[model samples]
Target: MRQWETAYEKWKNDEGLDAHLKQELDAMHDQPEALEDAFYRDLAFGTGGMRGVLGPGTNRMNIYTIRKAVNGLAHYLKNHCVNVNDRGVAVSYDSRHMSKEFAVETAKVLGAHGVKAYVFNTLHPTPLLSFAVRYLGAAAGVMITASHNPPEYNGFKVYNEDGGQVTPDEAAAITEAIQKTEDELSVPYLEQEEIEAKELLTWGGQEVDNAYLEQLESITKLDADEQEQTKDLQIVFTPLHGTACDLVQRGLDNLHFHQVDVVEEQAVPDPEFSTVDSPNPEEHQAFTMAMELGKQTNADILIGTDPDADRLGAAVKNDTGDYAVLTGNQLGALMLDYILRHTDPKLLPNARMIKTIVTSELGRRIADSYGVQTMDTLTGFKYIGEKIRQFDATGEAFIFGYEESYGYLISDVVRDKDAVQSAIFACEMAYYWKKQGKTLYDALQSLYETYGYYVEDMISLKLTGKQGSEKIARIMQAARTESFTDIGGVDVLAVEDYWTSERMVAGSSQPEEIDLPQENVVKFLLKDDCWICLRPSGTEPKLKCYVSVRGDSEEDSRKRLTKLKTAMDHFLHRTQS
Candidate 1:
């Protein structure tokens, strides 16, 4: 209680806080729970970076919190760079509350420390920011977005010079710097006008867009004839009132898809995302308006991208005359097959596809059939991006990369998952399928028949607030301590503990090292090509369990999945209790 009082006094006396934060603090002065929630602990920097609810607290995603993060980043950059002033940071944001403000604040903080800042003229997708960082040879990048989080949520993602999210080691160094900054207000910020006077701040525009688009085009395997035949294919797309409107639509047009229909209601950017309960395209509801528009146009395919345009979702008409939303695994496998089949083997003699370990192994089988290599990374797109960066450094060809959570990257143009490129590819593939007198669903069915049936599902258990955080920690600990030899009546062949960087094969004398960076994740490989992974969400207080199974038929796959899900649920309940 005494420590809490002291912290409150310091906050009250702090003159550097924004007026809104001060007001909130005053209103919550008598509310102990609110204050504790707000200041209980500073937001932790994790694999991808900081994300949280938007509010007035150290744990929130407000200007002060953003400044603290930037201050730490600035310190790290200055110390590491020989020419600190010349090394700038690229900034981009999405259509979320205060997203632009956060971008500007980040720029101001960078400028105050004598670092140049290059900011987008307006809200842009997160992947574009990653591209700009490497394109401009900037020291780092900052993207103000929560990816597909709910309306009330926002976040700050930091990228290193490699255009990948800061590696864990780099993040730890930045975290140390942030902790050294005793007061957030002590961090200096340059006024917008002052930054412009010194020409320290630059705006990204058509030049960057042109370069990015050209690179996006290079990834296409479409021939002149294919483009001509597919140009008139009817396609419906929605950005979900996010940042993908212009880039994705224009990319499709460039790909020669002439009959693209944009969902006008969602074409314009809206911070509130008024049309959908959540802007996440993974949810079928996010595509409601677009699906309706698709039906009206008799479109061959419907597509949606999240607010920041880093993730993509699609729906295709099924044999039942109803729209079936394709799972991320299904979409990824389809895209991988299409790209591999269309491209000449000579061009990609060393071509490769990448996906997270928890993603469907069906993709691996598909790649194998095409004589392409498939690599599995830990469960974040950043890991995929890291592999892409490695491929770029070497001479390996990166054909595609995706995760099971609706995020995908089709081209190496942008290091991160790019909905813009995925949108174009999805439309082009839909057109090709339509030319064969079939829908995307039909294509999926054909693939399933060719390969064995594969099924995957995710279960996320939400635990909110501080207590929830503790409980999540306990759950992870319990999983770490326990050894399950069997699940769903199948033998557990091996356990991969990412946090400990160890892979323990059942009955093995010793564990092997898992080369990926350490994170709080565990995966158990079961017999019969089935597996399950458990991890806590980086942005939210939730435990995410992923299950996958392979069977001879769709029905068999469903039965296996049902049994596995039930077993998982029983374990979850027991642990929680």
Candidate 2:
């Protein structure tokens, strides 16, 4: 019998397993495909930590796997951190199935290792988790969420004492320790009562929340009157049935925004996320309820946050009396402009911003217009957060950081992308524009007219299971060997292979070194400053193609994007053939 099949047999017969899990295992006994997929391999941490379908398998996220992962983390913390009993870990969960349970399970595992655990009293947003790490003076942190993934999935993200996501070295060390945590099923999860009695566990809520809320005032540049006047800007807020409803509503209300209306259906947390096709705010349909509420209130803007409230999506009323969904790039650029308007970089000479390499260059352009320097990191908010720590000194200041996927951070109070902060600032931006006799759409148009119309789009091709993985690898290999002169008849200015950390200048044999970490990514810079980037998504089973273009007008930019997408589609598909 195969390794997985043998493992399945053991699971079916093990009396140590929970009856509920045993029943689930028995039902899948006849389904070889299901069993194989579940036990073929353990779900390892990716850019967003270990995320997979929740069920009774090594590959799935369940109490056992959670215990194993926590065991590894406990060992890692012990090896690297001192004073573990004092400066321990801060833990929190989102509104997902088993989220609360996982939080307790993690705390129990830590307690077994003699580490202190400060867990939230209830479900909370991701940013709060980040802040709690710093607020509690923890040596590390663990957040239980699959940020924006479907309800069937749950994940775990670890943070170091700096409140940033674990660095590559940290992840590797923890992974190694986890590999040493043999017999994952035996990893003990102590009872909560015993754990608390031992002083290894404590519940944290109101204190951390009030402190987090108080930090919001630090990110806002507006004074008392300015905040009060923002009440005139009619806006609709939706948490998408996740965790942001309370925090965002309070942020807006505290800012004295009188017209803020939250979508009632989405205000409460729901593990099922029954409102839309998915809880991700990046998808236009996720904003459906918020838009409905916007129309009902005749609101000037609409904002929605994903399940964990780490990602945000916003729509602004256009000239046609309809709400137009703003791309993540558009919103980022707008936020940059609005932020700089309030932040005087002249006095803060070391002020700078950070963004991902695949994000729009329009942000760089906007920052340059104000004499603020912008830095680029590889994809993932962790890199940006890392930069924040590196540059967070007396001289160097972090103005703001954002990703093209609707993640933004105005302050390092939380060392991750914060939708709560973004939503607050976005609302203030809309209101600031409204006070200027302009709509958010109008403000975006003005940005384009000034910086040249910059448009961006992404295409993700899904391929599932083992065969799909092999096919994807082959395509990436083809990209390595193949060369192209032009895409859509536009001459390729240069080609950058992030895997090699080398950039091949156009018409030149020599390659330039790139000062970024090596990853499976490639980019082509075109003659007219347009660009295309290709890479497999770190957190999903899909290959993503990102394209950005800057043209004189919106129509011209759209035409260029369409043509480039067509040619790129043909180009990539040919590789598989």
Best-performing candidate as measured by lDDT: 2
TM-score for each of the candidates: 0.96, 0.97
Tell how far residue 448 is off in model 1, in angstroms: 1.2
Question: Residue 301's C-alpha lDDT in candidate 1?
Answer: 88
Q: Which 10 successive residues of model 1 have the least lDDT summed? A: 223-232
* Tens-digit lDDT string for candidate 1 (1-577): 6554666677778887689979978998889887787777787777688999888877778898888999988998888756767868989999999999998899888889889989999889998988898898888889999888888889999988888888767888988988888776667899988998898888776777778887888777677666545375788889998999899877887777778889999988988888998888888899899888888998888999999999999999999888889999999999998988888878665998899988999999999988888888987888887888788678898888999998888877678888888888888888778778888999999999999899999989999888887777877877778989998887899999999899999999899999887889989899889999999988787989999999989899999999899998888767865
In model 2, which range of ten residues has the least summed lDDT? 341-350
What lDDT tens digits, residue by residue, belong to model 2 across residues 203-225? Answer: 97989988998999777778876
- Candidate 1 similarity to native, TM-score: 0.96
Model 2, C-alpha of 535: deviation from truth (Å):
1.7
Taking all chains together, the TM-score of candidate 2 against the true structure is 0.97
- Which candidate comes out best when scored by TM-score? 2
